[model samples]
Target chain A: MIEKKYEFSGVLRFNHWVRVFTMLVLVITGFYIADPFIIPFYSSEPVDFMNALWRSWHVIFGFVFVASAIFKLYLFIFDRESENERISFFDFIKPRIWVQQIKYYMLIGKHPHSKGIYNPLQFVIYTIIFITFIFMSLTGLILYMHLYHEGLGGLLFDILRPMEVFFGGLASVRAIHHATMWIFLMFIPIHIYLAIFNSIYGKHGTMDSIFSGYSWHQKYFKRRKNKK
Target chain B: MQNRGLEEKLSKRLEELSKQQGIDSTKSIQSILDAKGFSRREFMAWAGAMTAMLMLPASFTPLVARAAELSDRLPIIWLHMAECTGCSESLLRTDAPTVDSLIFDYISLEYHETLMAAAGWQAEENLENAIEKYKGRYILMVEGAIPSGEESMYLTIGAHGTSGEVSAKKASENAAAIFAIGTCSSFGGVQAAYPNPTNAHPLSDVTNKVVINVPGCPPSEKNIVGTLLHFILYGTLPALDAYNRPKWAYGQRIHDMCERRGHFDAGEFVENFGDDGAKKGYCLYKMGCKGPYTFNNCSKNKFNQHTSWPIQSGHGCLGCSEPNFWDTMGPFEEPVADKIYNTVFGGVGADATADKVGIGILTATALGIAAHAVLSKIKNPQEGEE
Candidate 1:
């Protein structure tokens, strides 16, 4: 009983690359955006010259980000579910299996006991992160529009006034924007590490799958290669 | 050996210096020779510069040509009280003046404990002598606060009876004007934090004399030096704030001038450390940053030779300039604004910005999540039934 393998489509490749490219630029420019040191990195330019650039690009790329997310949603909604069913409800709740999968990656335990294109836990964690990002992206937009444009932003500012205290002050709000950068930073190494691991060990052609749209699967259905 | 030309003027002056010898001239001349000091040719050139320093209007630098003659620097008496020597370090760190230059030349330092080698009773006596010789003519610089209440036992000075500040009190009494340097001396910095054991207060608290408080954890050197220059020229104080600090240095708040202010007005925030928002360099008011209430010229004056202030360094302004800043400005908790509490504790601020942003984000995220959940549920209805 061989499990069928499905591949990522061209649209999926587009979404993945756009998300990666935009986020990388966002993170680097974002660092300078946090603080504006006047001292020049070299002789005369000052360290924070890039901070100005960060603000403009952040605003511009944010639109691209939103569009990309929307395209992802369209695909998720319209496309058929992968024959492998990598994402599932059981993956959301099974912490034990999640931990076990994580342990397998570290080589501290035997291979994971679960089977699927993605373990249940991977779907669960990604779902949480994805949802949070959507909310953050929306809030970020409202905040931007409220500032550069007029009319509706005032109403938004009025509503946000109470929570303004949550930021402590403008300086702290700047800090929040600064620290959120690390979350995306954390996700990057993890995402890359997993993709590489699948390529080398699982022999799934995971890296190319993102581009070529076809994944290698076992010839036998519903059974491990070694098992009878 | 005497000539009337500039060269003659120089040689004749040297002859007069050797012939009219005295203890003061002899000792200084000997010290200079021992140090392999400047040649006579170099000395005259430098003498021209020193003369300008003395005669140039203290408030104004004049043109480049006129500032060349030697001028007498105003006499300054630096008095230390209960302090950690940080203010001295701050003042002396000026690369422009260079600590060596300040100690050796620039201002006429009649007496300074940290910099001067003179010590014990001689040091104490020198302070008294300078005050007595130049009373109402020299600047009285006080570092650290003078604790008024109790025995003042927290700080001890040379041979003071009950109060630890016997020397400070005496030195302060005889000087022309006083500068309370550092937050401790100006506004009782950290020592005056809550429940001050010594019952510490700035120099202004103890005396009726005009005291200009330069408030900062360590006051900026330019503010300290520039204020002195202003005073020397004007023959009066720089305009004082309600707290008696120079208005030129304390007129603006850090909030009013911050570069990140746009993001704040726009309502962008970093929700947590190292999150996307943080990386994006949004605002930090939520993370307990204090920039609004504090008043100081740090944004403009900058630190380390106009290098960068704390906020620009990615740390919040601790409000070291304000009175009782330790108590009032500590604890980075929010005064009131955005949301995303410690832990996953969920709540939303109705701040005008947050409401609009939150409402829109909430509506969209909720709708998106709900739609995702429903569509997934409907797509696999039997899965949900399980």
Candidate 2:
């Protein structure tokens, strides 16, 4: 029998969609800032601040991205509606579960039974993505300090200057930030592909779970006579 | 030249100040030029150049000349720490002493390790006496980084073996203004790169007072002289950038001012060391020129008396003026894209760039997904087969 299960909570889906929107905006504007491909018309007066415009968009989305990540962390830790998400760490620490998951991915074993919402591999990858998010936010803030030296930027400067030095310099910080963007770009495709793979192969409605907060699962019946 | 009235007025004022200070200013600048075999015409030419360098109007030429003439009024104390004295050599080692160098010579340098003839106890005594005498009046110029914390033992100065950290702290305690004269003093230079055995730190890290960083491997003579002149002319610090470098000199990116910038805009670049494009004097961006990121006036004020700089001579900018350049802007013969840190595998993938690793993982994912799809199709021949 096929059973419908209410899996993802509304808050979790909201945070996911916010991350999606902000990541797309951040990446597009970030690449523009790095190497501005657009130019003002040659004959016209060079007055348009195209680079600055792109940079402002990038920073705005960057903050939104960070806020969404923080919200997700809060959900992972304290959200009563998603308390089971924290139990993924137990699966992450189990060597047998990791081995079974790897074997299943290698096509040598049946799909491993996961104790929580995510498998061990998914849990680990998500953890790394979170770390990358933190790094991106920090380097962005450091770079921002140079552009705006008053108010928020000035305050960040005093706090983040030592961190900049620890990272070797502003240049290294920039390199790291640009590099971390690529991580998200790489993750997005695999994440979608895996979701599709699971949805089709597992017959679990995994992809629809993110959007509709419900998924279908196989139900097992005990060896007993029906009441009817 | 055209501003003769301003020139006369400044000269008269300088004379009165000279009388008040009991120092002869009438021929002090002229005498230094004469001793160095430099003519009054050459000095005037230099003054004109300085006026232009300082971004002043033509009328300010006389003001610049008078500033150089009155350079003696500014008492300076230069300290040498964990450095090679390259900054001092760059300023003072011209085959023929330019008027700029003479102006530096004309300054009332109360104490300088490289220029002074005194040594050992006598040199120590001179430093002590100068610090005591000038008190809070002299400009303190430091040439190198100071070892921090317990690593202060790495660099000890004077006959009594006083640590660099201690010396810098003491010298800067009573300074009117402080200038970190090179990359070493500005951002700890190479000594603080990577492993940083000495635990070296920039001059600003050790002192509470604001330090105007004049950072370069060896900063241009014009930059050094221009900063000093600006201080003398205004009697207050010039505007500073985020790095505490004088905005007048470090405001614009080297890429914007570079002569090869046209080539960069046109998308013509030098791909290799001796390629046709390189021979054609194309942009060095492909060869890891850090000009786009580096903020300095190397292109505007070329080194060795406005002759040529690194980019002009077919070499990429080392980005030496920037902080921690040795660690951040290295593999200087290639573009920055190739040096992006491999964040995935950490040190194991140190040589691999983010692009390479990212593309590698992406390609693998695509292939794996394709392979997995094929395997799943073969394993499950019909619906609900499992």
Candidate 3:
């Protein structure tokens, strides 16, 4: 028999989607700021501030993304409902689980059993994505220091100046910031495809679980047995 | 004319001061105001402006003036390599102290290839004499990149066919301080750009000394003068950034002080040259301005006697002062490419490299996902009974 059980809380779902939304906004605005693909024309009154407008939005959402990430980190550590997700770290470290996960993706083996919210691969990939997010934030702030005479941007100068030098120069820092955006772009499609793949092929209602915080699985699944 | 009158008096005063401690360079410097039509007030005003340009506090103006007038006229040897002599021209063409002040009363410029009337064996003798007399005391100011790839045949100076690199190294070995006077000397300007056949290198690269880089396409006259004055006053090189450029002048990006920055913040940009927005003094960032990334005091300092800078003239900054700018900040108008590993996939343009990699991975991902889904369906035809 199939049984339904809660898998995610409302907070986790909200934060997950917030991350997706912000990443999209950040990428779109970032690309426009980098290239300004818009052909400019002579405007009599000169009201168009497209690059400035996009950059403002990018910074605003960047703060939101940072806050959301912090909140998610807190939840990952202390929230009871997130214990399953935290357990994924253990599976991620196990060599056998990685072999099984790779084999499963290669279509040569069945899915590896785990007592966690995410598979080993998802855990490893998500960890790297979060680390990249932190790196991007630091580099982005360093670039932002170019615009201000004082205040937060100015205050950041002491710390960021040496970092700029360490990275070779401001130009190199900017290059790294731009390159990391592509990493996010590449991760998104594959992340979506896998999420959908599991929902259909695994037959566990994984897609609906993200929205409703519940999923149907075999009553005798090992995870359920362990929970009892 | 008036400056020439001052020079004569200064030389006479130098003869008097020379008897005491060989410090004849100072007495005449203090008497510069008494020489002709110029006033002490005019000297002070020039000194104040120079101090301000050096990013020094207002209180330092008097100190700067005193240092300028009373300090020993240190010997300076100006060497030209693969350069156009534009840096020398910029100094000579300015109107403040004018070229007369730089040559006559300024540091005793003993050997300058461009300015010295001597040539052939006579000029070579002057350089040798100055180096011997002031060895380990004279300042060595290099104005161009040194081509070391050949026997330095690309640019040879002196009668002995001595390569530029060899000559520079020899001069720097005994110099009190070394000043790299232009982008070519400081950062290997145009000659070091991509496909650098001559294998040129900046003064710092060719020499072991800590080079004080006054970098610009041709650095502003004041920057060159200010650097020399700072050395004379402090008896040490000015504070420098990571690129060895003076922190006072290159500490801030041009974008910070740009007048059109309001347009940038407001998002108004000139789409093209001679457009209405261009006429209205909009930001030139859209037209490939590198001001946002370039660090220099150009906006505040200006060029040609504070008349205007590139942005004021309705063009974007070429980021000429930064290191390896030719290869790194290219296609001039577009933002620099975001590559951590520059020169990794050699010969590919920055954006092209990113584009090829991004598109390649995205395409492979899409195709792999599609094939995997199709294969899964074929393998599980009878298993779907939901």
Score residue A99 of candidate 2 by CA lDDT: 97
Worst-scoring 10-residue span by lDDT in model 1 chain B: B63-72
Q: Rank by lDDT, highest first.
A: 2, 3, 1
Compared with the true structure, model 2 gives a TM-score of 0.72
Which of candidates 2 and 3 is the stronger one according to TM-score? 3
- The per-residue C-alpha lDDT of model 2 at residue B98 equals 75
Q: Candidate 3: lDDT of B214?
A: 93
- Give a tens-digit lDDT track for model 3, residues B2-72: 64564454445444433433234454654554654567777788799987877666766766775565345
Estimate candidate 1's alpha-carbon lDDT, on a 0 to 1 scale.
Answer: 0.59
Give the per-residue lDDT digits (tens) of candidate 1, residues A10-87: 777778899999887766555434333232232232334443455688877877877887777777667664433344
Alpha-carbon runs more than 4 Å astray in model 3: A4-12, A37-51, A70-96, A115-117, A221-228, B1-42, B57-60, B70-72, B94-107, B148-156, B337-364, B384-386
Task: Please provide, for model 1 over B12-112, each residue's C-alpha lDDT reduced to its tens digit, 9 standing for 90 to 100.
Answer: 43344334312232234224433555454554443343224333322223221121111123467887777788878877766555322342333356677
Candidate 3 lDDT score relative to the true structure: 0.78
Clashing pairs in 2: none
True contacts reproduced, candidate 1: 0.01
DockQ of each: 0.02, 0.20, 0.44
Residue B328 in candidate 2 has what lDDT?
Answer: 83
Runs in model 2 deviating more than 4 A are A1-170, A204-228, B1-27, B34-41, B340-350, B356-386
